[model samples]
Target: MMRNKIIEMRGIVKSYYLGTPNELEILHGIDLDVYEGEFLSIIGASGSGKSTLMNILGALDRPTKGHYYLDHLPMENVRDDGLSQIRNKKIGFVFQTFNLIPRSTALKNVALPMLYGGVPRSERSRRAAELLQLVEMSGRSHHRPNELSGGQKQRVAIARAMANNPAIILADEPTGALDTHTGRLVMDIFHRLHQEQGKTIILITHNAELAEETERTIRLRDGSIVDNRMNGHYQLEACNESV
Candidate 1:
C-alpha cells in the first residue's frame, strides 16, 4: 500500500560559526523520509548529531543548508511566526525531562497548547480531560508536577503532547528518566497510540533495544546515517533493561 509522506528532509546540513575559522559542522548531510502512521526510531551515541537532527525534525531549528517538507509544506519558506504556528499545529514533542509547569495541574498543563492555539475555554477543558484519559492520567488531572511520580509526570507530558492532535509525535528519549518497568509502560502507550490511532511517531533515542520495538530504526554515527534497518520482531525484554 502506498502511504503518505509526513516528513521529508534532504541534504540537511547544520553548521555553527558559518564563514569563520571556528565553524563546526554537526550534521554532514542527511536525507530522510517518514511515512504517515509509521513508528520510526533514530538511534545514535551522544555528540553524534542526534540532537541536531531532532531539532531540525521538530522544526525547533533550521538547517543551514537543506530542504525540509513537513506534511508537504516547504519549511524553509516559513517565517518565525509561521514556524511557531506549524509547530503548534503539526509537531508534538515529548521530552525526557517531562517539561511540565510546576504550578499547574496535569489538566492545565495539557490544556496549555490549546490555550495558545486559541481553543475556547470550555473546549480546552473538555479536550484536556479527554487527552488525560487517553494517557491514563485522568485520575491525576488535579495534581501538580511535584505531586506526581516520575512515570505519572511523563504520562501527563505525553498527554500534553497530544493536545493539538499533531501530525507527528516526536518523542526525545521519552523514557530516559524512568525505571525499566515504568519506561516499558510508557513505551506501551506509544505502541497503543500507533496501533490504534495510526499516529506518526519518531523516537530519538540511544538505546538500540528500544529502537528495535519500532517499525524501523535508523542509526546515526558521526553525523551520518550508518544503518537503516526494518526491525522484525526483535525481543522486547532487553529494551533498556540494564539502564
Candidate 2:
C-alpha cells in the first residue's frame, strides 16, 4: 500500500529580521516528509534551528521562503486565523514546560483543546476524562498543575494533545524537565501511544539517545539537515532505558 504523507515540507527556509541589516537566517532550506502513523525524531544541538523548524511545522510561525503542506493543505500562504484553525484541528503540541494553565484542573487542561475546537461540553468532559485515563492521570483529574508532579503534569499535557485527535503530535523536548525515572515513564507513554493509537508523532530533542529510539531520526547541524536515517527497529527496550 502507498503510504500517505501527512506532512510535506520543501525548501523550508526561515529567516528573522528580513530586509534589515542585522537579518539572520535560521533554517537553511529544509525538505522533509512524514507519513501517517510514523514515529520520527529530529535531533539537533542548541543552534541547529530545531525550535524554528518545529514552530513552522506546528503552524505557529511561517517560513520566510518555503512550501509546507500539512495534511495536504498549503501552509505557506495561509492567514493567521487559518493557521490557528489548522493548529487546533491538525496538530497537537507537547512542550517541555507542560504549558498547562496553572489555575485549571488537570481535566480542564485536557479539555481546553476540545473547548477551542467547539466540541460540546458534555462530549468534551467525557473525552477529557477518557484521555486522562489513557495517560494514567484519571485520579488527578481534579488537581491543578501546582499540585502535580513534573511527570504528572507532562502526562496531563499528553492527554490534552490527544483531545482533538490531531493529524500529528509534535513533542518538543518532552522529557527535558523530568527526572530519569519520570522521563523514562514519559517516553514509555509515547511508545505506547505510537504502537497502540498509531499516532503520527514527531519528537524534537537534542538527546541522541532519545532520538535513536524513534523509528527515524533526522540530525540537524547549524540550520541544515546533516543526517536522516531510518532505524527500522523501534528499540522499545532501549527506549525504556534512561537517556
Candidate 3:
C-alpha cells in the first residue's frame, strides 16, 4: 500500500522583513516530504533555522516563499483564523516546558483542547480520562502541575497533546529537562505512540542520541538540511513501570 503524504514543502524560503535592509533569510528554498505514520526527527543546533521551520510546519507561521501542503492543503494561503482551526484539529504539540496550566488538574489540562473544540462537558471529561490512562498518568489525574515532578509533568503534557487525537504529534525538545532514565521513559512513550497507534511524529531536537532512536532524521545546519539519514534502532533500558 502506498502511504499518503502528510506534509510536502516545496521551494520553502523563510525570510524576516521582506523588502527592508534588515531582511534575513532563514530557510532557503527547502523541499521536503513527510509520509503518514512515520517517525522522524529534525536535528539541528542553535541558529540552524529548526525553530523557524517548526513554526511553519505547525501552521503558526507561513513561509515567505514556496508552497506548504499539509495533509494536501495549501498552507501558504490559509488565513490566521483558518490556520488556527488547523492547529487545533490537526496537530498535537508536546514541548519541553510542559506548558500546562499550573492551577489546572491533570484531568482538566487534558480536557482543555477538547473544550476548545467544543466537545461536550461529559465527552471531554471521558476522553481526557482515557488519554491520561494511555499516558499512564491516570493516578495523577487530580494533581496540579506544581504537585508533579518533571517527568510526571511531561507525561501529563503528552496526554494533553493526545486529547484531540490529532493526526500528527510535534514534540520539540521533549526530554530536554529530564535525567537520562526519565528521558528514556518519555522516549518509550513516543515510540509506543508511533509503533502501536500509528501516529505520525516529528521530533525537533539537538540531541543526536535521542534523534538516533527515531527511524529517520533530517539534520539542519545554517538554514539548510546538511544530512538526512535512516537510523538503526538504538536500545535504551526504559523503566518497566508505567510512565
Best-fitting candidate, scored by lDDT: 2
Q: Better model by lDDT, 1 or 3?
A: 1
TM-score of 3: 0.94
For candidate 3, the per-residue lDDT at 11 reads: 89
Q: Relative to the unseen true structure, what is the Cα RMSD of model 1? A: 5.2
lDDT for each residue of candidate 2 in 45-138, tens digit (9 for 90 to 100): 9989999999999999999998999999988778988998999999999999999999999999999988989999999999999999999999
TM-score of each: 0.94, 0.95, 0.94
Clashes of each: 0, 0, 0
Question: Against the true structure, what is every candidate's RMSD?
Answer: 5.2, 4.5, 5.7
Each prediction's Cα lDDT score?
0.93, 0.94, 0.90
lDDT of 1 by residue, 32-108 (tens): 99999989999999999999999999999999999999999999978889889988989899999999999999999
Off by over 4 Å in 1: 234-243
TM-score of predicted model 1? 0.94
Worst 10 residues of 2 by lDDT: 234-243
Q: Candidate 3's residue-wise lDDT over 86-107, tens digit each?
A: 8888899899898999989999
